[model samples]
Structures are given as C-alpha cells and as structure tokens.
Target chain A: MAVYTEIADEELERFLAGYELGALLSVKGIAEGVENSNYLIVTEAGPHILTLYEKRVDPTDLPFFIGLMEHLAARGLTCPQPVRNRAGEALGVLAGRPAAIVTFLEGMWIRRPRVEHCAQVGEALAQLHLAGEGFAIHRRNALSVDSWRPLFQRSEEGADTVLPELGAAILRELDHLEQNWPRDLPAGVIHADLFPDNVFFLKGHLSGLIDFYFACNDFLAYDVAIGLNAWCFEADGALNITKARALLAGYQRVRPLGADEIAALPLLARGSALRFLLTRLYDWLNVPPGALVAPKDPLEYWRKLRFHQSVDDAGAYGMDL
Target chain B: MAVYTEIADEELERFLAGYELGALLSVKGIAEGVENSNYLIVTEAGPHILTLYEKRVDPTDLPFFIGLMEHLAARGLTCPQPVRNRAGEALGVLAGRPAAIVTFLEGMWIRRPRVEHCAQVGEALAQLHLAGEGFAIHRRNALSVDSWRPLFQRSEEGADTVLPELGAAILRELDHLEQNWPRDLPAGVIHADLFPDNVFFLKGHLSGLIDFYFACNDFLAYDVAIGLNAWCFEADGALNITKARALLAGYQRVRPLGADEIAALPLLARGSALRFLLTRLYDWLNVPPGALVAPKDPLEYWRKLRFHQSVDDAGAYGMDL
Candidate 1:
C-alpha cells in the first residue's frame, strides 16, 4: 500500500526509451509490498511490475535479489523474471530511485490458504530451494538467529506494554534459542519471508512465488521450518496437524529431508518463530506517528513460539523422522 | 492507497460465478480512488476494475452512478463501461459492500499536465456534457452552493487555526456567494471532480475519465470551472493563463459556451474553490486517528479561492465573453 516515489510521465517516457518494452500504456501503484514502491505497469507488449527500491532496501543487495529471480526462473521455477533494459542491465534509475521492471505473474495470493494450498506451497518451496543451487552471489540472512538479540533489545523496553510480561517471556525464549539453536543443516537460498501473501495460486495450482527481497543464504530446512510456522497455524493459535502433514509430505516428495534435518525441525521452528516475533515486536513498539501501515500484532508470533517450545519432537507436526 | 475490504479467494470465486469473464487469473488491490476499494482484476476475458464501494458512498446512489457510466459509454464517451453479470446487473454485493466490475482503461494520469493535456481535458469534458444529455436518472449535486454553509459549519470552529482569519474570510465569501450565486445556466450531468488524476492520458492524448462517485446534475460551466482550477494552476499557486486559454478554447471548439455561462465563469470558479475548500477544511480538522489517507492541505483551495475572488471577469480566465 505504498507508492513512495511518483514517477513523472516525461521521466517515465525517457526511462522507457532505454528498454525494448514498447510504449507505455498504463502505470498503476499497487497496494502490495511494504519495503519498496511497486507499480503494475502495462506497456505495448504486456504487463510487468515496475519496482522502485526505497530507502528500506539496500541497493547493494539488489543484484542478489534480481539475479536469484533470473536464476530460478531460468530453471523453470515460476517467479518474476527481471526485465533487462536494451543496455543489458536489469536495473536502472527512475524518479531518483533504483528501479527495474519484471514480468508480471498472473495469479492472486490466496488469503485463508487451505490444506491443498499449503501442500502446493510446500512443493513450490522445495522447487525454489532446488532451483536456487549454484547462485554466484551470496547474502547472509540478516534477520536470522544472530540478529534476534539486537532486534529484541530495540523493542524490549516497551514490549511489556503490549502484553503483560511479554518482554520477560521473549527474553527467556531468546536465551534458550541462542544457546540451543541448530548449528548445521542442509543450507542454500531460502525465501525467508514466504508468507501466504507471497505465494500466488490459480485454479488450485501454485502459479508462482514473489517478493524475493527477503531471500538469502540460509539453511534450506530452516525455510521449511518458517513455512510450517506460517502455514500450519489456525487463526485461534492452534496447530492444524493435517495441513502440516500435507505441507511436509508435499515438500518431502520433491526433496526428501535428511535424518538430521528432521531431528532439528523443532529447534529450527523455534528460531524461525523468534525471528518474526522480534521483528514484529520492534515494529509494534516503534510505529512512527501518522504511519499508514498498522503494525501487525506481535503476540501472534509469541503464540506460535510458545507452541513450538511445547513440541519436543517433529511428531507434533504430524511428520515422522 | 486504500484496500479497506480484503476479499477472500472463495468469496471472489463465488462472486465471479455470475460473470462471463471466464476463469479468474489475478486480482491486485490498486492504489486508486479514495472513496472505494479498487482492485485490478484480470480474468480470462481481460483486465477490469473491481470496485467495492466503502461506507462513505451511499448505497442508494449506486444505480445513478453505474447507470451514468453505462449511458455515457454507450453514447461514445471514452470512460469505464460497466460490465454486467449473467443477471444483467452491473452492481452486486461483495465483501458485504456494494461492488461492480468495469472495463479497465489503458492510460496513466499525467502528474504534471501540460498545455496540450489541459486542452484535451477541456474537449473531452465538453463531449462528456453532450453525451450525458439524455441520462434518465438525475442526481442533484450534493456539494453545491446550498450545502456549503452546512459543510462549512462543521469546520468553522477550527478553520482559523489553519490560517489567520480564515474562518471570518470564509464567512464573508459564503455571504457574497449566497447573495449572487448564478440561478440559471446550461446544466447537465457534470463530472464534479475532474481533477488531473481522474483524467487519464496515453501517448499525450486524453484516453478516459474515471472516478464517477461525484457525478451529478450541475451547471456544465461549473464543471469547466473545476477543470480550470484543477488543470490550469501552477504548483506555486499562480494561474497559468496559457493553459487556461487552451482549455477554454478546446471546450469552445466542442460545444460553444452560452453568453450567460461565459459571464458566470468567474463566480462559478469562486463557488468551486469554496466547495473544495470547505470539504478539505473539514477533512483537515477531522482526520480520524490512525487514518491512512492524509488529509490534503485545505489552504491550497483557500489560495485558489482568493485568486478567483480577485478576478472580475471571464477575461482573467482567457475567455472572451
């Protein structure tokens, strides 16, 4: 719901001259993506997403993000392929911000993702992990276990205000995780923020995955843990084991989980939960005055973290080692 | 940038059951139209806009607005044509709000409209007035002179806080307008809010007009006044006579202005300024806590009102009476 930079018509026309995208037909600011401004731009050729990287996105990390899309898409994974300009560059400047156009994926992200949708997401996640092999660039997952302490420190002062004793609860969880976090698992590029909104579907089939800004080098099995935390929880903070089994079965069918990865699922799930909980807590505590985007309830992740803490084995997720 | 209603996938599928639009391809909430939740929905047929009318819009006026678009489009005006469902209905309920699908127009609204764009807008506006002649459903202009006082009353208490002596100045202008408001003029369906954003352009030609929520029966020349105030003013609050001349000339070419309509342009412009001023003032003083949409500066309209008050004749607008 952000269009931080407004591209002037003349400037846009000039920018399009460097591309073979044909004449511009329409450009609309889309209410999607929070980190950058996105426009569903239609040219004489077809529809594409025009993204202007805002201050939130580090310009240095864009090559990794854009190139990953290209690499994955070339391997038959459905994702937004960055459109290179005639000058042979995938990125350019528009409206005084780094911008690029990517081919538009044709499907809507399902809201209330059913068991079937979860299975499809699981399969897609595995495919993405496989397709991401041998990427030239490397980016460390900035919001991983190591970043949680500093992130929590920023929000710890006011976390109790949101929920009674929430700060103490978070500190206890963070201490437990910092000491017990898994040190080794199968690692590769993982879409760290593959929420339901980032996965698009059409006719009950997963059409594509989007929002690669959070993709980075992390344990591939940790990606599955993130998906489990995101997709297996019902609105009332209860785990839906049937959907979790379906998602895990779907992923295993594509890329079988190793014994160690299966053994470490609970610990990885706790770390994933803590990652989101800290970030959400930070945002909740630091919402600037007059900010348009409402900070999400941080306690949702708190509930998920507590559930993961209660599970001592992967069997709780309806999966067998 | 508002998508107030989040339509569920199952609900959207059920809603699309009534349309011949083929299978749904994608639906993205678009950041357009302040009064409604608009989505750029693509089905097998093609792109269309799905608008869910919010509470700000009266449900009873749905027929008049939708009917006006259908009538105007059928009469050869380039606007969004309402798409009827299998039941031959253009409006239906979706997400518990009145909703409709309309053909998507291919053009972007110019950010900084030049003289040519102003002229094109003028000609298109004249054509709209002509095309709207035989529309059967008539709606009185809700924000007309008769409503200004009551509207101003809501904001009068804090209007001075926005600017020095602003409330007193508004009262004086309201008195003058009520005493000398034009009683007789060529009246018809006018696009009462024809700001640049409502007028789209493609390759430098006006492609279409949109946002018909404010359409109602009003003085045709009054619409022209709104266009002039909207399109012919510079960023620094000075009038651009060249653009104003071009807009008026273009309108004259399509349908000649009557002598009375020409004579009343200055006063109509003043009333138009006041209309926008009072509304903006109300919004400025009454912005709801945590509201996403920022209220536009009310004093911008105040400056325009002052300029209109200083003009004594139509010549100031570059039109000869």
Candidate 2:
C-alpha cells in the first residue's frame, strides 16, 4: 500500500487465518497507490495480489469488486479470480484491514507502446464490452460529462493558475457540452484504462486484462474515446495518426462503431480528457505533504486538457464530437 | 466524492455543527475522488474546499492535517489554511464521514504549460523545501524507493500487464539509487507534485504551491529530480533544454544544488518516473465499471519510465544519477 503502516508477517498470517492461498511466501508492501494498501503475496496456491482497502474505497463497495471478479471470471474474462474462503466469502480482514486475495496476472507492460498494441487494446475493449453483457451487478459510468464540473469545483481555488478564465471557460464548456451530449449506443462494462500497461501481452499477443477497479457501463463509444485519448496521443501532446487508425480500426472489427458513436467521438474524448484533468487538478491541490501516497503529476493532465481543448470537432480523434 | 452515499445536505449539516468555516454558503458534491467526498463551499470566510473523509484518512489523523496546515501556513506557505472548531480542532464529522474545511486557494492552473512555468515551479519547490523545517511535526516521505515493490506486488496477480520486468528494473534502479542517493545536501519537506498545475501563479509570479498530500521530508535534491522528470521533460519525452535550464537555475538560486545531488539525478528521476508508472499502471488495471474516477494514462507513465530508463547519467537531466 502507498501509505505507511506496520504489517509484520505474523500479524498478516492471522488476517489470512481461514483462507487457502497456500503458504505465504512474501508480503511485500505495494507503494504506488493513494487509495489502497497492496502487497505482493507469494503462496503455495500460487502468486496472488493482496489488497487492503485504502482511503476512498468503501468497505461496503468491496463486494462490487469481489463480485465483479467472480462474475467476470465465470464469463471467461481473463482477470484475477478472487479466492473464496471457507465460509464462501471472497473478502476478509487482514491485520484489521479489509483485505482480499486475487490471483496474479502475467505479462510485461511494454515501456515503448507501439501502434499495433493500441489496435490490440481497441479490439480487446470491444470484446470486453460484448462479454460484459448479462452481469448481475450494475453501475453506470459515474463520470459521464454531467458529473465533470463538480470535480473542477473541488479545486476552484486553483482555477486561475493556467487559465485566467478557467472558471468561466469550464462553465461555458459544461453548458455547451451538456446541451450537445449524445445518447443511445451499445452500452456495457468497459476497460476504461486501455493504456498498454493495463493490457497484458505474452509474446506479443494479448494475454489477460487486469485491474477492473474503474470499469463501468456507459456509452460503449466513450470507452473508445478514452482509449483514443490515451493510446493515440504521443508524448509531445500530438496525436499519432498510425496509432489512432489502428486502434479505431481494431475496435471496429470486434464491435462495429455506429455513425452516432463516431459523431460523438471528439466531444466524448474532450470530456474524457477533462475528466482526467479535473481529477488530477483536484489531487494536485489536495494531497497532504509527508503523507505516504504519491501525487500524480497534475501537469500531464493539464497537457492533455490543452490538447483536447484545441480540438473543435470529432474528426481530430479520427472519429466524426 | 466519487462514491458518496446519498446523504442530503441538511442531513450532513449536523456534522458541521462543531467547526467554524464562516457561514457555509453552499455545498456542491465532487464526484471524482477515491478518498474524500469534497464540496466546493463558498463561505463568509471565503471560498473553501470542504472534504468529508471517506475511507483512507482516519478521524484521529485530522489533528495532524490541521497541525500540518497551521505549521505550513505559519511558515509563509501559500496554501489553504485549515479551519478549526471552537475546541481548537480543525476536524469534525459530517454525514457520517470525518470532515473539515480548508480555505480555497486562488489562481488558475495553467492549461497549456510553458517552459517559463517550469522555472517558476522549480523556484516554488525550492521555496517549499526551504520553508519546511521541523515545524513541530514529523512525517517521512514514505514513498521512497523502498515502497515501490510492495505496492507492485499488491496488484501483481494480473499486473504482468505492467509488472515483473518493470518491477525488477525498478528494483535494480532502486539498488543503484540507494547506494548513491544524496544525503548530505539540503533536507526538508518537499512539494513533490510541483507540476505546473499545483503551483498557483498570479500573473508571472508563483504566488503559492498547493497539494501537500505527497509532501514529505526527504532528500531535498530528489524533489528536483521529480520536477525534471515532470516540468523539464519535453512533450516528446526528451528533456526540454530551455525548461531544464530555467527550472534548475531557478532552484539553484534558492537552494543551490550540491555535487552529490547532481550526480544522483538520473537514478532519482528514474525512481520518480517508475514510482508514477507503478501507480498509474496499477490504477489502469484496476478500474471497475461505473466508477467515476478516470484511470490516468499508464502509457504516459510508461513512456516516462522508458525515458528515465534511457538516461544513463545525471547529466541527461543537465545535472551530474
């Protein structure tokens, strides 16, 4: 976990008292999160990821994650299947922290993401959308544009740093976009973060997708827009043509994009970019110093926000917003 | 708050019974955080950022935050000063969540960050480090290189999408960095996320630095490396020479870089990038459907990791890692 807390091996063993993840080989604490305490756990049952609920995540909502995994695994989605205990619950307490044991996924997150990987991501996302059908639990994409502004308001004090007119500009964009947001498209659960690191590759072929914490059902095409903004944008803040094309074309192969989805692409992509920008902006202003959690570079999202703001139409994203 | 329970404003009013935020004018829900349910509150005390602590932060820790703010504010740090209750407590309860109000900072976050902005940021960070003395509190920069693997392991089960080799590479870098990390230079609390957005600028001058959540007492020089990886990097993943010169020169004017710190620059930058990559990578994999939070672009961090990995010397950052 990103925060500091003492967790001795013996203290942890009690938390795993009834589970069968095999013998605990190691409980190395994970350090790159602001929301949870994670440990790399090696066990006889095999390698598993152990997570202790950190700030922001509700223990009540733990079931959603646990149940989602169970459901996804049953549907053939290659994800970490949560291990159930003797009482049949997949979650438990470890060292007084809400905890769970998740099977380890395998693959290397490529440092140099290639154009083809973008396409592979696009294809995989489409397949995931189709596969997510019939899941028992339900959650709407909580971050659709209607919800974007309120996040900006959280950091209202710092709105003027980059834009002399940030508050007004954001308000105007929200009003305009709200009036123009699209409706009616194939909707289902989506792998929102299709960055190469989230898509596994074993020998250059897609292996298993992991990290379902931000998955949600929304405009299926919005997921596509999110991917485009993420996978197609180059480090210099320029959109890569080959990468964009491959990603779109690959996704289209699995789940054909309708004209409306294409027409809404740019607006949705801007919204997606703003979504990240706003969150990063808030985080940049709020995280306490000397706290264990790492704060993301708020400027990167600012960079992406600038790129999105420059776009006046959907065509910029290789789609028709 | 991204996943707040439906508690009405009036229902949450009682929790505000104790604290004095100076006549709360309005409460607007922020739907994009993993930790706290925040409200943009306008009050007689002025616009304030109101937060209802959700999961990660404890009610007991409120004093630390309150004291932390008071200490920093006392030192001339331009950030939100925590509002306290009649009993000298800066925290209380709101809607069943631990809550408090912080004065809103004013200044817009720049959307399109410029090279000059980097210089301002460098200067501001140095100012922060210099200002963060003992201040009657002690909290470590828990996110030092030692914390990386533990966090990666928590998401390791299926994180092969971005783990294994990345973790190992980071481990090796950590070893090299640990052996050579600067220790004798300046040491103090740092605004680690001194990205352009986190620093408030009134006109061309940096009026304040916001977001001390990741603020910690660490090797002050490492903070500079974090800035280099962030503000000084070009959009193309290469070091932007002008920004690098401006930022470093600006910081040097304030704190003056030491030879050991300069020599350790590459590894420090690599550590910073890897730290972010691991977190972004984990979040990328864990997004669940319908969660309002947008997963950050792991590719961005991945690219950063690659860039840092490619740097063989501290001079790559125009310093001597």
Candidate 3:
C-alpha cells in the first residue's frame, strides 16, 4: 500500500503522448506493490498498469525484468506484456523515476490456497522456467545463499529480541546452508518471489504470475523449493503433504527433476527457508519509516525452516522415490 | 492510500455470492480513498468499485451515501451507481466493515485543472444540487460551523506550532465566521467536499463527480463556495478569478443564484476554507499510525483562508453583481 511518487496530470499526458495507447482515462494508484509506485491506468485502448520503479529497484537490472516479461509473454505465458511507447521503449521516466506500462491481467490471488492452487502454481512455475530457456539477459539472484550470511549479520545483534532463540538458530542454519548449499542443480530464470499475492487465479484457474523485480538466474530446483515452502504450508505452520505432492507432481509433469535435483531438494528447501527468514528478520527488526506493510513475522519462516530440517529427502514431501 | 482491512479471497467469494455480478475475477485495492478500503473489483459482469467503510465513516450514514449515489445516478448524473445484490441490498458486511459495490465510472481527475475543467465541474455540481433536491435522506454536514469550534479545540493548542500566527488567526477567523455566518439561504443537499480529486474529467469534459461521503444537507451556495476554493486556487495559493467566474457562471446557467445566495458566497467560501483548514490542521498534528498518506500541509488551507479573508464580495470572484 504505497504511492511513493505521484505523477501530475500534465506530466502524465506528456508521458502518454509517446504511447500509441489512447488518451489516459484514469490512473488509480494500486495498493499492491511495495517496491514501486503502481497505478491501474485506463485508456481508450484498454486497462493497463503503470509502474514507477523506486530507488529499491536497481535501474540497471530493469532491462532484465522488462525483457523477461516480454520474453514470457511472447512465449504464450500468461503474464503482463510491456506496452512500449511510440518511441519503441517500454521504459521511460515519470515523476523523476523510471516508469513503464504493461497490459493489465485480470485475476485475483487466493488467500486460502487449496491443494489444487498449489498444483496449478507448480505447473506455472515449471512453465516459467521452461519459457526462460531462450531469453538472453540474466540477473543474478541477489538474495541467494552467498548473500544470506551478510543479510543475517545485519539482524544478528538483536535478532533474539524477536524471539529468545532466533539469533542462535539463524546462525546455526546459516553455517549449515553455507557448508551444504547445492552448487550443481539445474539453473534458469526463477521468479525468486512467487508468493501467492503475485500469482493470480480466475475461475479456479491460474491466470498469471507477476512482480518480476526479484526474477533472476538461480537453481530452477531452488525455485521449486521456494514454491514448496510458499504454497504447501498452512496457517498453523504445518506442511500439507497432499499439497506438496500435488505441487511436485504438477512440476514434474512439465520438467522432471533429475536425480541430483531430487537429492538436493531438502537442502535447497532449507536454504530457501533460511534465506527468507534472514530477510524477514531484518525487516522485522528494522521496519523502514513510512512502511505501508506490517513486517511479516520472521518466526513464520523459522517454523518452515525447522520443518525442512526434519525432512530427510524429497520423499518426505510426499514424493514417491 | 489506504487498505485498513484485508479481505480474504474466500470471504469475498461468499460475499459476492449474493450479487448478480457473476464469478469474481480480480480485486485490486485502490490507493485513492482515505477513509475506506476501496478495491477495483472485476467480475464476469464488469469492473466496479468495492468500498469497505473504515472507522472514520459513520455506519448510520451508509444509507445516505449509498442512497445519494443511487438517486444521483437515476437522475442521469455520471457518478458511481451503487450496485445492489440479488437481495436488493446495496450495502453488506465484508471483513467486519460495511461494504458495497458501485458501478465503476471511467474518468481521471485532472491534476493541473484548467479553467474549462473548473467550469465543467461548476455545471456538474449545480446539476448535482438540483438532482439532490428531492432526496428523502438527510445527512447533516458534520463539519459545518457548529462543529468547527470543537474540531479547532482538538488542534488549537498545537496549531501555532504549524505556523507562527496560525493558532490565533484560526481563532479570530472562527469568531468572525460564527458571528457573520448567513442565517437564511437556499439550503439543499450539497456536495460539501467537492475537491478536484472528487470530480473526474475525460477528454477535457467533466465525466462524473464522486466521493459522496461528505455530501450532506447544507446551503447550496456553500457547495459553490467549496468548489470555488477547491477548483479556483492555483498551486501558489493565489485565487484564479477567471476560473472562479467560470465556475460560478457555469452553476448559474443551471440554477440561478438568488440575491442572498450570491451575497453569501464570499462568507461561505471563507467558512469552507476554514472547515478544511481545521481538519487538515488536526490531521497534520496527528497522522494516524501506519498512515499510507502524508498529511497535507495545513498551511495550504491557512493561505487559502487568508485569501478568502481579503475578498470583499462575490464580484471579487469576477461576478458582476
């Protein structure tokens, strides 16, 4: 829920002059994205989303995000297609920030995601990974294993303030992940943050995946691991094996996991959980001023990490080896 | 920018079950309204605005607000028409808040409004007042003169902290307003808060007026005065008499202003300015916790009040009285 920058009507008209899309009918700031100022813009042509890239997003990495959308849309993936201006540029400046327009996708994310939703998301994630095969640009995953320790270090001092054993638990997990992090699993462009909110569904079907700011080249299997943690967990922090089996089955139907990938799933799942826990811990400790969102409890990820620690292999996730 | 309540997907589906709007497709929280959780919901039927009334709005006034929109829309005004469910109820409970769906009006509020925009708004407002003539429901303008003293008292102690002479000036103005306030005028339902953002324009024509939460029974001329202050003020706090004249002229074309109404415009304008100034002062002093919007500078209203103070008559607004 943020509109960090506001575009004046005159400025918006001037900006839209470069686009073939018809006159701007409306621009309603969407209380969705936290990393950017987003507006649900309507024009004579159709409804679209106008986003102003904020300081948090690296301008240099924008090309990768935009290009990935274009590539995915071109490959028949259901994602927002960047609407290029008449000058043929999809990205430009608005209100002193990099801005772009994308065609609006019509769907809502399910809060209480059923096992079927997990299965559908798994298929979509596999499809996204497959679709990225021919894309040229690459963005390194910034919150990957290598960055975890440094991120955890920032919150390490007062981490116990959140929970008595939180700091030591994170330190131990970081050490374990550092020593055992898989290096040779299959890699491709992964929507590093495929949270439920980013995945839209319509009429009980997955419509699209959005928010490509975190998309990057990472272990494709790690992406699967991330999805496992995100989609297969209930509110009580318990793993739903039925949803997990459905998710993995749906993924394997598109791109089967190799023996090494299967072997590495548990460790990668733990690493994914630890990665999120560290970042959530940091945000939980130091909420930025004027943050519109409440800090998600870091302990949520801590619980997930503990569950992953108990898992011996992918088979524990209801996968029959 | 506000989404005070988070609606679960399941709850939304169940709520929409009573509506004829077909299956729910998408729900995007709009960062526009300050007093409600508003979502641009789209279903098979089409796009509509779903408003979850926040605590700031009185539940008893829901009937008035919803009824006013329905009445205005039926009178051919291009505003959001409250959509009734199959049960014929326009308002219902969603996420423990009063919620309603209204037909989505397509138009954008001009940021830098021109004279033509002001003129169009003037005509539209006059039409709204006339259309609201037979409205059975009555909502007292809670921010009317009788309430200003109490509102000011809440912020009076810290008012001068915002400006050097702000506190004393407001008290002085309040005394003047309460003494000289017009006793008898053409009273009707007025869109008391006809600010620029509430009026929408498309292709340089006023398409609709919105946000009827502030609409109430008041001196019809006061509505004109509010619009004059809102739409005729330049960014530098200077009054644009040409715009003001166009606005008044536009209104006069629909329903001629009586001698008393014409004479009362200046004082009403001053009162309108003060009303907003006091509320803004209160909000400026105390922005709610986790507020998504920055408190607008109360001094802006103070400057407007000072400008209104200097005006001697309606002629100062370019009307040849």
Best by TM-score: 1
Structural similarity to truth (TM-score) of each candidate: 0.98, 0.49, 0.95
lDDT of 1 by residue, A203-315 (tens): 98999999999999999999999999899899999999999999999999899999999989999999999898888888888877656566788889989999999998999
The local distance difference test score of model 3 is 0.90
lDDT for every model? Answer: 0.92, 0.68, 0.90
Output the better candidate (1/2) by lDDT.
Answer: 1
Query: lDDT score, residue B204, model 2?
Result: 51
Best prediction by lDDT: 1
Clashes of 3: 0
The best candidate in terms of DockQ: 1
Candidate 1 lDDT tens digits, B1-321: 433689988999999999999999999988667789999999999999999999889999989999999999999999999999999999999999999999999999999999999999999999999999999998999999999999999998998899989999999999999999999999999999999999999888889999999999999999999999999999999999999999999999999999999999999999999999998999889977656676788888899999999999999989866
- Candidate 1 off by > 4 Å: none
Regions of candidate 3 where Cα sits further than 4 Å from its true position? none
DockQ of each: 0.79, 0.01, 0.66
Q: Considering lDDT, where higher is better, how would the candidates rank from best to worst?
A: 1, 3, 2
RMSD of each: 1.2, 26.7, 2.0
TM-score of chain A of each: 0.98, 0.91, 0.98
The better candidate by TM-score, 1 or 3, is 1
- Report candidate 2's interface RMSD in Å: 21.4
lDDT of 3 by residue, B100-126 (tens): 999998888887888998888889988
How far in Å is the alpha carbon of A105 misplaced in model 2?
A: 0.8
Candidate 2: tens digits of C-alpha lDDT, residues A1-321: 235444644456666667866555434443323467665555556456777776566676677667877787887878778987778888888667788888866554444568878888888888888778887777766677777877778887887775677667667777877887887776887766666556666546677787676777788888888888778877787888688888888998998888777777777787777777777678667766434434556556656766776776666656422
